[model samples]
Target: MRLKSRLLPLAVSLPLAGTLAVALPLAAMLHAAAQPPPAGAAPEENAEEPGLAYSVSLPETGDSALDDAISRASALEQLRERAPVDAFGLVSRALAEANNMRDALRSEGYYNGSSRVTVDGAPADTPGLADRLAARGASDQPVPVVITVEKGPQYTLAPVLLRTDPPGFPLGAMGETGLAEGQPARAQPILDAQGRINQALRDAGHPFAELGRRVIADHDTRKLEVTFLVTPGPRALFARPGVTGEERTRSELLARMVQPLEGQVFSQERIEKTRQDLLSLGVFGTVRARAGDRLDEEGRLPMTFTVVERPLHAVGFGAAYETRYGPTVSAYWEHRNLFGGAERLRLEAEVNRLGTTGDTSDTGGKIGASLRTPWFLGRNQTLTFDIAALRERPDAYDRDAFTLGALLERTWSPRLSYGFGPQIEFSRVTQDGVTTDYQLLGLLGQLRWADVDNPLNPSRGTRASLLVNPIYSMGESNVFTRLRAQGSTYFDMLGDKGSILAVRGVVGSIVGASYGGVPPDKRFYSGGGGSVRGYTYQSIGPRTAINEPAGGLSLVEGSIELRQRVSGPWGLAAFVDAGSVTEDPTPDFDNVKVGAGLGLRYLTGIGPIRADIAVPLNKERGDSAFGVYIGIGQAF
Candidate 1:
């Protein structure tokens, strides 16, 4: 068997005849075997016990990988430690394990490897071996068993050959099929090469490509030769896609999304892109695309888009706590496919600063409604409308406002987008004990780019956005242009989200207006859990005569975090944040404030639940010594 150059049989039959000889009761069987026996007692050939225990030890095979594989694949090791077996049963298991170990070696390119099994220092086939162990008299000691292997020289590959059934079918480069001469002929790599060939053919418009392989080993040269047989059906173009399983979503909306792919050359990349586009509509839980088995008369392939829609309506609530700013709560209700065109509508409300100050004027809450219409006027564009009414009392100001806005957003590519719209607002603001009413109209413009792998918890890539707003005050007759830009990037220090470095930066300014001329709600302030962290909400900017935040015309903020995953569903993060806000049109670094913090994270299906504690590095007389924040998702 050692020199067979092929895998050995792994199955072994139990010889019940050996156990039948010792079927008598233990007390009588032991006495008969030990002594010369009673005058009329029948002589038993082999003695055994009902309870037999043994431990298996595998010696080094000079190759650590092969030795580990043998231990994992051994049935004897798993059963002996778990199930109770008699002496004869144990011997039968050991005989089966010998062949398993040999197969393990052959999988690692050692076709000529050999394995030997023994019990109590006797070969497994030794006559009366089980009787020797059981005759020791029902002792509790575990019998010792040993398995050893000798792995010979590993096999290498001869030149790999690829053949197409139709002969000369376009397969591109066959030389780079991940197989080469003299490379180790391991089983996994050989199988992976076949998958690569099939995928390549499908990517080149051969949707029904099939692959077959033949592996032959020459023990004389210690080499394996492999040939991949390919059957590439017919080249195909994509036909109009058919959709199914849509309960509320309109079929015309889906057709509009896939119109660009119809009559085009079939491509795996395009299919994946179309699938992802459907999922982004927020109505589908899963989307799958399949190709027809037969090509049409025009040499075109029929495609189908199968979808599973998510629940049409959902409601959720969230809560967060901060040490000095007190607690905040929020809730939202959403309809995913309103009007049957995959339109989304949501209503939300939030309350903040609970249990902080005894005065009711210190608390704030707001309610708003938003709607999104997909495929609005164009395939790559969407229309969004929002209306909100809110009253908020932060350290910077106390104000009440009602706002309405609409936007037309266009997606240029998977990673880039831009939008522009008009908005109107009516507000009554109180700043530093001065109250004023104003009606404002503005033009809103925005640009965004994102290439991150995950939105809630990202370990790689960058996200960035820019906003420009030009507002005109009806009563004050003052015009101001607001500009803000923010960007964040993530580095995967250790692959697979085990360790990451995340960085964020922001800059903003209000041009053509003084700090006092702009409305308080529009002015930028830089403290709170989402900002500097160690101070109260809106607490880190320019101050008035009474030592309260006066809001600022310019702002700058930056943060850096090191995130490390500790174990399953748990992680840790350490971060530093810095920010500055000034009455000037540009940032003043001299007024920068810094905070340092550590956080704990529990990962869930939606995102990571995070809790952070931070201390002010440059503390002031009124600043809190430390701030604690709890919420969902990474603190970007």
Candidate 2:
């Protein structure tokens, strides 16, 4: 009889004629292979017998592709805590594993493959195998299982056909659906082609598309043919959208956030986008958007948004430590839905430099409150208000200030946003024992673009931002403008294994003012964990006679990092950072500083926890030999 075109569902096990010539007891073989027990135990006669153990071996097949497929599908390779306790259990498992190997070969395009399982010079299906195992006494020996496979010629695909009722759709334009003549005949590609056809129809405004498939195999030619029948249903438009699971939140507000207009063409893309928008509000724990099963009387598809609200109130606290700044602590309390329109209010406080050996006056703290309103006046827009009081003393200056500001931000797309705002500040500044009070009015504008693959741990993409702030000192005759731009790009060297190369650059300048006229806090300074790493904060700029820092008007910085994932939950990084601060408005590359470091990362659910140790490449007097920093997230 000839083999049929259909798959072989049952595994075949038969005894080999000459393989069992040496018939030795199973316990004797196990004893010779077992290792001695730990020391200081009772004598062998008095001790309890050790449990049975087993090991599996798969020899190379001379064909790399076939060997890899067998390794991936081999049940014996994936077993961890599933080892059998007795000889009978071991023989039963061996018989089942033979079937698993045969199925694995079929998935890889090999339809005529064969597998054999053997245990200690005998086939797994030997009659009276259980009786033979019972004859051996209890022994602390390990059993050996060997699996061998012979993968036949792979089958290729034959002519492929797709039929639709309309007969005018260009199916070829759907891009590589993975089904093509002369390619390998695999089950995955055939299923993928069916999905692609259905999605193409739906994307083209056919909301109710369906697909059916048929496959035929020819054993003589070793070829497979596939066909798909597509049903392109009638076109449909979106109907009025409804919201569910609303308690404290107003339905009208959520409707505005959804923004699905009636009579628009139905689109799966739009439905998914609406779901993401609702989740971004931070007020919902879950959001789902789906279309009605059938078209309405008017040929319109009704849409529904179901959501689960998050807790209205929350409180969080965090802390970090650095060699230069001691320990810093922060806390915040928030009301996610202060009013009915997805408004948020948060109050926060922070204190830094708790146990540092620097000047006692160089400690700092702040208290602030902020409010944010989503969907302000238009879609993808937000309005924010902030008020704060801060006191900080650094190497260059001391500041006591109060600030109030309002900003209006608009998100043009998923990757771009722009904002403009007005701020007022009243500050008391002290430098070199001289105290001066000033009131300032400023207008700030900012633009940002980011298309990173991930927000917490990105391996590829780019991020950039620009800010321009013009300020007028009401107490002094000083007017200056601060312009800054920074950008970073990430590249993945090894896909998904977390090997990445990241580069960043920053440049800034102060126009319309001399070095002496710029506010100490407003001027630029670089060197710290957030900057040049190895040096202390504000230590790279000009200095007084006593070696205290004097802030500068121009700044330029750049950094490069090579990150590699070591193992699960662990990673390693090597980096180099360089920057300069100049007194002139335009950077002259004077007094530049360079720092290099190595870091360790432990990945977590929220983000990566980082620890870095750095040394100054161009160390000056009074600079620390090295610095250590511990924090959350990437350095950028």
Candidate 3:
């Protein structure tokens, strides 16, 4: 397993004093201390500060001695959890890192010989002076620094060797020629050869084949060689992998899912995939595996699995906040083993506390449940029946809705999926405390293509979805046919400085929304948290019956984002988004709200840490909507 890095994001701007560094050389200050003494002190004598101390104060340190000072400070902090100098450990580390960078600059030929290091201090009589000077062994003495560099060492590869008899190793058909069939013994090439050799050995059934001494590089002779002495001391044969404690699932079913085939070698990829394939089933709560017990065949190993399933009858309740949904809490109860069999039944309730519901009211709630036939259409298809009621609260707008729907979903392939359903909706919307009622009936089909190489941290891939609904409604609402299409694709940057550039777009329309006018609950409105950042939610669609859109619909929206890693510990992204909702698809762009901003992401394990500020291109009077979103995972 990989260990996660524990570093925090910077929430505030760094102090201005930290941004400046003198360009000129600062040296030759031997007044007993590097800094000038405190205020109101004697004019003559060794002018020393009262709170500057150090254990190692050399009489004659060089101009760039700050490098040494930084190193010492870092080492002291790491060893004792405290820098020898009186300063926060984090501050010491930051300064030490800066000092090392300056030293490296000199080493890289940006040297200016006449440089000085000055860290001043005042009398211990000042407030909090004692606390600042709390570093052990600190005194009124000069702390030495060293800033110089010399050439780094270089070595060459020696020979290529592998302990295991990789397929066609020494040469031949090259499936595992060990060194790519007579390739040059370069430093990196040798290491690559070793890795390939290890894979080959494992492929041949020696699951425990080991590689020793990665590369042989000689300094004297500009030569290089890669060697991997695999410990393929014994021949290991394949047998059925062990599956223990799975009384719930058929042993045969579990065996079939444990992949890489029976005879394949135990590689990390295969082991991980075995876990993933099982996870996709969503049956077991936790999964774990390993290359089972070792046999006496010197370097042979077996694979084994120890799995524990979560309770079949489970109940859970959780609360989540989304810019689009506002704040919602859901409570659910699911029974995997239903009717003494393998079916599932679930019930849930959801509530919302913000955003307009076409009526611009401010309080809403939803409760719904689904009874699913898990074995529908032979395990791959899902047959679901559900009923729900929703009460929405938009700023100055509000609506309440009741829905009854049924859906059939199927996953035909890894890359293709579809869902078809029919729904009936009844709602009452309130705007500025005024309420109205509406009704809607519709049938819809949805298709999706979501095959990204990495679903969790996808850098490149395409995902597109289409939604269609033909419905009829009345009572202060429009009865119309709806069509919606949206897609997003990403591509990684080319060359060495690789990153990802992604593009996304959405377009929805009211096909025949001509009669009865759009109801307060049926018409789409735009602006707010989720739609165009810097705006509100659902505020992007069509206008309301009042001639002004409480939540605009009927518009085309799109955006392009360019992302890159600006530093080892940081990520940078820039994006521009623009869109608007009018009577038609060809709305004037001049009236569209366009926003742009930059975001910074620190690779936090919780997910990508993000902070973005979007400014509208066409800022209108009293248009003061700017979005701020923070959470785990990517915005998508």
The residue-level lDDT of candidate 3 at 131 comes to 47
Model 3 quality (TM-score): 0.57
lDDT scores for all predictions?
0.80, 0.76, 0.53
Ranking by lDDT: 1, 2, 3
lDDT of 2 by residue, 1-636 (tens): 211122233333323221221111212111211222123221211124333466777757676755665666555554413333356666766776665665555555565667898876679899887457655656566566789887667768888877766787666534445677889866656656767776777776678776665555555666666667666778788888888997888889888776655677777887777787788777999998878999888878988999999999999987777777677899999999999777999999998887676555667899999999988898878999999999886777889999999999998888999999999999999887778898999999999999998777789999999999999998778899999999999999878758999999999999998887888889888888878888887889788667778778899999998989999999999999898998888986767799999999999997899898899999999999998888888887
Where does candidate 1 stray beyond 4 Å? 1-68, 76-89, 130-145, 173-175, 476-478
lDDT string, candidate 1, 95-116, tens digits: 7666566556656677666779
Residue 89's C-alpha lDDT in candidate 2? 60
In order of appearance, the predictions have TM-scores of 0.85, 0.86, 0.57
lDDT of 3 by residue, 406-495 (tens): 889887766878889898887777753456676777888899889665664458888889988778775534457667788888787773
Model 3: per-residue Cα lDDT at residue 191: 39
Clashes of 2: 0
Q: Show the lowest summed lDDT stretch of 10 residues, model 3.
A: 23-32
- In order of TM-score, best first, we have 2, 1, 3
Tell me the number of clashing residue pairs for each predicted model.
0, 0, 61
**Which of 1 and 3 is the better model by lDDT?**
1
